[model samples]
Target: MAIKLLSQFLVILVVLVSLFVNNLVLASEQYKDPIVIGMSAAFTGASKNLGLELYHGSMAYINKINQSGGINGHPLVIKAYDDGYNPLPAIENTVNLVEEDEVTVLFDYVGDPTVTKILPLLKKYEAKNIMLFFPFTGAQSMRQVPYNQYVVNLRASYREETAGLVDHLLGIGHKRIAVFYQIDAYGRSGWDGVRKALEKYGLDIVAETTYRRGTEYNSSFNPQVQILQEADPDAIISIGNYQACAGFIRDARDANWDIPIANVSLVGSESLLKLLLETGRKTQRDYTQNLINSEILPSYEDLSLPAVKEYRNAINSYRGKSPITKENYTESGYNYVSFEGFLNAKLMVEILKRWTDFSDQDQLHEIVDHLNDFDLGIGVSLQFKHPEHQGLHQVYYTTVSNNKFVPLKDWRKWSK
Candidate 1:
C-alpha cells in the first residue's frame, strides 16, 4: 500500500510539470511571430521624396515600439516595397505583401492613381488594412466609398485648406480670389472646395486656370502670368505641387502680379521650398513678399512640443543624422512622417490585441468600424465610424518667413 501511494504521487507530479511546460509554449508562440505591416510607396523615380520620408518615419516608430518591448509584448515587423510611383508595380507589391508576406496591416503609398489601382485587390482579399496616412495630397477619390473604409487621412483635405484660405482673405477684406490648379483629381478637388467655401462668404472666384501635370510652360510663368495678370485678382490660390507652383509663382512675380499667394498642403514640403528659393535666385527675381503655406501637420521646427522633441531624438538615434534639409526640411516636417506611421502601427496593434482571434476577417472589420475619436497628436484627432473613414477634418495655416513656414492660425476643422 505504501509503495502504491508513493508511485501515484510521482505520477501526479509529472502530469503537473507537463501542463506547466505546455502553457509556457503557448504563451511564447503568441509573441514569437512579429505582426507584419506592409508598406508600398514610390521609393524610387519622381516621387521618391514622398516615399523616402514615409519609409524613414515608419521605421523610426517601429524601432521605438520594439525598443519598448512592442505592443502587448509582441514585436512588429514592417515589410516595405517600392512601387516607383507607378500603378502596375504598386498592384504587384500589394499582391506580394498580402499573399506571400501575410502582412496584418497596410500603410500609406504616394499617389491616388497608385492607391486606386490597389483598392480592388484590398477589397477582394478583404485585407485587414487598418490605416493609411498622408497619401501625398488630398484627392477626393481617396476619401470616397469602399476605399475610405480602410483610409485615415492625416492632412487636411483640399476643401478644408481652401476654406481656410478663403476665410483668411475675407477677414483681410480681399474679395476677388483667383485659382490655378492641376487638371487632375487633386486640382479638381481643390477647385470644388474653393468654390463652395467662397459661396459661404457670398463671394466667388474671379479667375480660374488649369494646367497639365508636366506642363513645361509651368517652368516660366510668361504665358500663365499674362493670363493671371489679365484677370487682376486680389489673391491667388495655387493647388499643385512644387514644380508647378514654383513656376507659376516665379512667372507671376516677374509679370509684376503682386497679390497674396496661398497654396495647398501638397506644396508644403522642403523640396518645394528649396525649389522656390532657387527659382527666385536663378531668375534674379522676387515675386510675392508674404507667401502663405497651409500645412496638414505640425512644423518640424517646433521643438517646444514634447512630441517634436521626441521625434528629433528618434531621428537622430535611428538615422544618425537629421531628416531636415537646409532649404526644405524642418524638424516639424519630418514629424508628420513619424507621427502618422507610428500612430497607424499603434492602432493596428491595439486592434490586434482586442481581437480574440486574427484568423477571422469579419471580426477585424467590426473592430475597425468602431475605431472612432482616435488621437495620434500629429495635428488633428481622428474619428472613424462605419459610414465615414476620412478620420481628420482639421487644417492649420502657416506662412513662409525667412524661408521657414510659421503657423498663422489655430487648427480649424471642417464638418459635413
Candidate 2:
C-alpha cells in the first residue's frame, strides 16, 4: 500500500510540473510579442499637420525606446489609421482598431468631434478595460462624469484654456469679448467655456460667428469677419482648427480689423502661422499681428525646461526615422502640436513602466490612479487619481514674435 501511494504522488507531481512549465512558456511568448498602441487622427485633411506632427513627435520617443530595447524587452508599436478629421472615419478606424487590430491601448487621438464620437466605444468595451490615452483635443465631453473614467488626459481642458484667455484679457481691461468657432462639438466646447468664464464677471460674449468644420485655408471667411467686425468686440476668441482659424485671421487682418484675436491650442499654431505668413507675403499684410494662442504646453524654444531639451534632442535624433513615418511626411522643424505629442508619448511610457502585466487591461486605471505627484521634468508636477483623470492643469499663452510663437509675457501689449 505504501509503494502504491508513493507512485500516485509522483504522478501528481509530474502533472503539476508540466502545467507550470507550459504556463511559463506561454507567458514568455506573450512577453516577447510587441505591444501595439492604436491611433486614429487626420492625415490627409486641413488638420493633417496636427495628425502628422503628433505622430512624428510620439514616434521620436517611441523609436528611441525601441532602439535601446523597448519596455521590458517588448517593442511598442502604433497602428495608425487616418480619419481625415471627420467623425465617420474616426468611428470606422476605432472600430477596426478595437475589433480587428486588438491593440493594447488607444493613444494620441486628434480632434474633439472625432474623440467625442468614439467615447461610446469605451463603454461598449468596458469589460475589456479599454482606455484612450492623451488625445489632442481639450473638449469637456471626455473630461465630464460618464466618460471621464474611460480616458486619461495629459493636457488642460478647453474650459481651463478659455478661462486663462478670458482672465488675462479682463486683467488687461478688455471686457467686451467675442468668439469665433467651428460649427461642431469642439467649437461649442470652447464657446461654452468662454461664456462661463465671462459670466463670472457678469458679462457675456459681445458677438459670435461660426464656420463649418474642414474649411480650407483658401475658403473665404470674409462673412464671419464682417459679422464680428460689426459687433466691434474688444477681443475675439477663436475655437477651430489651423485652416479655418487661419482663414478667419487672414480675412480679419485683411479687412483691417486689428482687434485682439486669441486662439485655443488646438489651432495648430505652426500650421496657422505658415498659412498666414504665406498669405501675408502675397498681400503685404502682417496677419500674425495681434494674434495670441493659448497653449497647454510650454514653448519648444524654451531650452531651460528639461522636457523641452529632451524633446528637441529626440526630435532631431529621430525625425523621419519612426517606423510609422510615411515617405511623404516632411518635418516642419519643431512645433507645439508635435511637442505635445512627444509629451504624450513620454507620459504613456511612464504609465506603462508601472505595469508588469499587459494582459490584464483592468489594471490600467488602478495603475494610473496610483501615479501621484509624478514629475516629468516639464516644470510642473503631474498627478492622476480616481476622480481626476487629467494629469496637467497649467495653461500657457503665446503670441507670434519674430515668426515664432513665444510665451506671452506682457498682457498689456495686447490690451485694447
Candidate closest to the true structure, highest lDDT? 2
After TM-score superposition, the amount by which residue 28's alpha carbon in candidate 2 deviates from its true location, in angstroms, is 8.1
Q: RMSD for all candidates, in order, please.
A: 6.2, 6.2
Q: List residue ranges in candidate 1 displaced over 4 A.
A: 1-31, 127-136, 214-218, 280-288, 320-356, 369-375, 378-381, 409-416
Q: What overall lDDT goes with each candidate model?
A: 0.67, 0.88
Predicted structure 2: lDDT? 0.88
TM-scores of all models? 0.78, 0.91
Root-mean-square deviation of Cα positions for candidate 1 versus the true structure, in angstroms = 6.2
Q: Please provide, for model 1 over 168-209, each residue's C-alpha lDDT reduced to its tens digit, 9 standing for 90 to 100.
A: 787776788889987766677788989999999788888888
lDDT of 2 by residue, 6-61 (tens): 99999999999999999999888556878889999988878888888999999988
- In candidate 1 the C-alpha lDDT for residue 117 amounts to 74
